[model samples]
Target: MCGIVGVVSHQPVNQLLYDALLLLQHRGQDAAGIATNHSSMFAMHKANGLVRDVFRTRNMRTLQGNSGIGHCRYPTAGSSSEEEAQPFYVNAPFGITLAHNGNLTNWEQLKEEMFKNDRRHINTDSDSEVLLNVLAHEIQKATVDISIDAETIFQAVTVLMRRVRGGYAAVAQIAGVGLLAFRDPYGIRPLCLGINETEQGNEYLIASESVALEGMGFRFVRDIAPGETVFIDNDKQLHTRQCADNPSLNPCVFEFVYLARPDSVIDGASVYSTRLKMGEYLAKKIQREGLADDIDVVMPIPDSSRPAAIQLALALGKEYREGFIKNRYIGRTFIMPGQAARKKSVRQKLNAIPDEFKDKVVLLVDDSIVRGTTSREIVQMARDSGAKKVIFASAAPPVIYPNVYGIDMPTRDELIAHGRTVEEVCREITADALVYQDIEALKQAISDVNPELTSFEASCFDGVYITGDVSREYLDKLENERNNPTKAAKPEDAGRSQLNLNLANEG
Candidate 1:
C-alpha cells in the first residue's frame, strides 16, 4: 500500500505537501516523492526514504508550485528502485503527473497493452507508471490539447475505470487544466476529499486517509464515492462525476485491522472503535474457547494493537500491561521488504519488559499474524523474559489468502495459515495457546458500530476477492514475480541503513 496526497491552493504547496506526507509516512516507508505544477511546468523530486529524509530545503525550493501532489510508496507492484519512485510524470496528455494508493491486478496486461496498442513504453516495473500512461493515453485520445474540459477529463476516467481492474485511489495533475482524482469501482481502497477555506480562497486536497486532511487543518468533507471522479479546475472549481453505474463500497477490512492508523476514519467507520470492538469480540472468543482462565496478564505488542489490547483486558477482567516496548526510531517490521530483513528488524523494533512478563502467564495480543515469523519471535522474547507461559491472540481472523488489492502479501506460500490448521500454526509459532477471532465475529465487530459500512473486502480471511477476478493461476504468476531474484532488489537488501534515495533527476 501507499499514501497519496494532492492539493490545489492559492499559495505554494511544497510545505503543505511535506507536512501531509509526514502524517501518511506510516502508510509507506519505502520511498517518497513530490511533484508540483508551476504555470504548467512540472518539477518533481523523488527518493527512496521516509518523507523527512527525502525532502530538504533545497529540494522543496526547487519544487515550486501552488498545486502539487506527493506520495509515500510501499512496493506492492514494483521493485525497490529509485526509478520506481512516484508521482509518475508523463510529458504527453498535457504533462500529467499521477500518484495512487493500491495495486492493479491486471498491471502486466495493461503494461503490454500500453506498449502494443497505445504505443507507450513503460520504463519502470511500477504499476503507478503504467496507470499514469493509461490515463494519459485515454486523455490524449479524447483531446490532444494542453487543456481539457471537465467533461473530457471525466470521459477519460470512465475509460480508465473500464480498463483497470483492482483497487486504486488516484490523484493526478493535468498541467494547464486542472487536478483530477478517482476511486475504483469496488472502493477497495480509502480516499477522501477535504477543503480548507481561507480569506484568499478555498483550497482542495485529496488524501488516502482522513487523518492527513484533519492534521493539515482542513475540513473533513465526505469520502469520494466508488468509481467517482472529482476534477478541480485552475479556478479551484470542483466538478464531480460518478463514472461507474453500479459501484460497491466495500473498503478493505484489513485497513481496520492493521493498515490504517487508529485516529483515522475510513468509509464512515471509526478505525479506533472498530479495533476496540474487535478486542471485545476476541474476549468473547477467548471465553468461549476456555483460554481466559489460564491468562494472568494481557500484554500488547505495542503501538497499533494497544487499543485492542486495552479493550480485551477490560472485557476479560485481566491485568493490562505494556509488556513490549517499541523503539520509535525503527521502521515497522511488517512493511519491511524481505523475510530476513523483517525478522532481523523485529528484535530491534521491540523489546520485552522483563518485569511485566516475569513469572506471569502472558496473553500477547497483536493485530494479526501473517507469516508467523514475528509472532514466533515475540513468543520467544516473552519466554526469554521469564514468562511462565506465552499465549498469542490475534484481533483478526487467520490470513489464509494473499491480499492483492494493495497489501504486500501476494503469495499463498508465504502465509503461515495458508495450508495449516490453527493447532498446527500454534505449534509452529510455539505459543502455549493461540486464539484467533472468528470470521463472522470479525465482520460483526467492525460493522456493529457503523451500520452504513454493511460489507467489507475481507479477502485475506474469507479468501473472497470482492472484484471476483483473482484466480489460482493469477496468484501463481504474482508469486513468481515476487520471488524473481532479478526484480527483488529492495532498499534494505542494498544495505542502505538510512533507507533514503535522491531520484530528483530521474523525474
Candidate 2:
C-alpha cells in the first residue's frame, strides 16, 4: 500500500504536499517522493526512506510549483529500491507524473503489451511505472492536437480502465494542463477529494484518506466515487466523469480492521465507528463462548486496536487497561518489509507494563493476527510479565488468504491461519486461549456503520477476490515467484540512498 496526494493551488504547493505526506506517513514508510509542475516542467525528488528523511530543505526548494503530487510508497509489487520510488514520470504526449496506491494484478501482462504492442519501454520493475506508461500511451492515443481537453482526458481514462485490472487509486499531474485523480471500478482502495478556499481562489486536494485533507486545513468534500475521474484544470476548474462502464462500492474491509486511521471516513463509513462495532460483535461471541468471566482485565495491543479494546471491555464489563507502552518512533510492524525486521521490532516497538499484567487474566486484543510473529512475541511478553493466563483476541476474522489488493501478505505459508484451525493457530502462537471475530460479524460491523455498504473486498478474511480475476493458477504463480528468488526481479544496487530526476526542464 501507498499514500498519494495531489494539489492544485494558487500558492506554492511544495510545503503543502510535504505536510500532507507527513499526515499519511502511517500508510507507507518504504519510500517517499514529490513531483511538481512549473510552467509545464516537472521537477521530482524521490528516495527510499521516510518522508522527512527523503526530502531535505534543499530538495524542497528545488520543487517549485503551484500544482503537484506526493507519494509515500510501501513496496507490494516491486523491489525496495530508490529507482522504484514514485511519482513515476513519463514525457510523452504531454508530460505526466503519476503516484499510484494499489497493486496491479495484470501488470506483467500490461508491461509486455506496452513493450510489444504500444512500443513503450518500462525501465523499472515497479508496477507504478508500468501504470504510468499505460496512461501516457492512452493519452497519446486520445489527443489529436497540441493541447488536450477534459473530454479527451476522460476518454483516455475510460479506455485505460478497460485495460487495467486491479484495485487502484491514482493521482497524476499533466504538465501545465491539470491535476487528475481516479479510483478503480471496485472502489477497493480509499481516495477522497478536499477543497481549501483561499483568498486568491479555490484549491483542490486529493489524497488516500480524509485525515490528510483535514490535517492540511482542507475541508473534506467527499470520497472520489468508484471508477470516477476528476480533473482540476490550470484555471482551477473542476470537471468530473464516470469513466468505467460499471462501478460498485466495495472498499476493502481491512481498512477498518487495520489499514486506515480510525479517525478517517471511507465510503460514508466511519473507520472508528466500524471498529467499535467489531468490538461489540466480538464481545457477543466471547459471551456466548463463556470466556468473558475468565478474563480479569482487557488490554489493547496499542494504537490501532485501542478503539476495539475499549468497546470490547465496556461490553464485557471488564476493566480496560493499557498494558503495552508503544514507542512513538517505531514504524508499524505489519507494514515492515521482512519477517526478521518485524520480529526484531516488536520488543523495540512496545514494552510490557508488569503492574497491569501481573497476577491478572490478561486478554490482549489486537486488530488481527497475520503471520503470528508479533502475536507470539507479545504473548511471551505477557507471560514473562507474570500473567496467569494470556487469552488473545482479534477484532477481525482470521486472515487465511493473501491480500492481493495492496497489503504485503502474499503467501499462505506466511499467514498463520491459512491452513490451520483456531486451536492449531492458538497452539502455534502459544496463547492460553484464542478468540477470533466471526466473518459475518466482521461484515456486519462495517455495514452497521453504513447500510449502503453491503459489500466489501474482504479477500484476506474470506478468500473471495472481488475483482474476479484471481484464480487458483494465479495464486500458485504468485506463490512460486515469491518463493523462488531466481524468478523474481533482482534488486538494484543499494549504494545510493536517493535519486532526483528532472522529468522536464532543469531551469
User: TM-score for each prediction?
Assistant: 0.95, 0.96
lDDT by residue for model 1 (399-450), tens: 8888889998887778898778999999999999999999888888778878
**What is candidate 1's local distance difference test score?**
0.89
What's model 2's TM-score?
0.96
Worst 10 residues of 2 by lDDT: 498-507
Name the lDDT of candidate 2.
0.92
User: Residue 10, candidate 2: how far off, in angstroms?
Assistant: 0.7
The alpha-carbon deviation from the true structure for residue 358 of candidate 2, after best TM-score superposition, in angstroms, is: 0.9
Among all windows of 10 consecutive residues in model 1, the one with the lowest summed lDDT is: 497-506
* Candidate 1 colliding pairs: none
Which runs of model 1 end up more than 4 angstroms from their true locations? 144-147, 485-507
Q: Local error of candidate 1 at 122, Å?
A: 1.0
Question: Which candidate wins on lDDT?
Answer: 2
Residue 282 alpha-carbon offset, candidate 1, angstroms: 0.2
lDDT of 2 at 369: 98
